[model samples]
Target: MNVPELFEEGWYWTSTQYSPNLAWSQSFDDGLQGNLVKDYEGRVRVVRRFPLN
Candidate 1:
């Protein structure tokens, strides 16, 4: 897909995490899947998914 399409899909996924009406908690399941970690300033962050087995 093009960059714009990819960005829109990403935005949709991120927004779902903030939805209050979802049946389950929307926080990332770190234990179930590895994630892409980035260091911003002094803080470590997981901004994307890693390989899922």
Candidate 2:
């Protein structure tokens, strides 16, 4: 079964704060993760996890 199917080829923002000028980001298609300038505009993804315990 398909889950969370928002798989679009684009960059997304992450909560991992890098610095005053850059922030962490990730891609959905190519699986590229890196930092980009704070002024750069990209897609955002907010995720939540449930404990298996």
Candidate 3:
């Protein structure tokens, strides 16, 4: 998959929940996966999956 033109360099929330107060996040800048507080400000990317038939 290719990165979108409007991609921003920062941490983005994932669907995975790390804990009651933390969640999984990914960094677009360096492709790092980490956890961040639920209340912290972050970016999000809306995407959909398609079958490779």
Ranked candidates (lDDT, high to low): 3, 2, 1
Once fitted onto the true fold, the runs of candidate 3 whose alpha carbons sit more than 4 angstroms away are: none
> Which candidate achieves the best lDDT against the true structure?
3
Local accuracy of candidate 3 as per-residue lDDT tens digits, 1-53:
67655678888999889999999999888889999999999988887788776
lDDT per residue for candidate 2 within 8-46, as digits (tens), equals 678899988899889999988788899999899898866
| TM-score (all chains, Cα) for each model | 0.14, 0.79, 0.81
The candidate that achieves the highest TM-score relative to the unseen native structure: 3
- For candidate 1, which ten residues in a row score worst on lDDT? 8-17
Local distance difference test, per candidate? 0.26, 0.83, 0.89
- Off by more than 4 A, model 2: 1-4
lDDT digits (tens) for residues 1-53 of candidate 1: 12332232211122222234332112232322222222211222335656765
Give the TM-score comparing model 2 with the true structure, all chains together: 0.79
Question: What local lDDT does model 3 show for residue 6?
Answer: 67
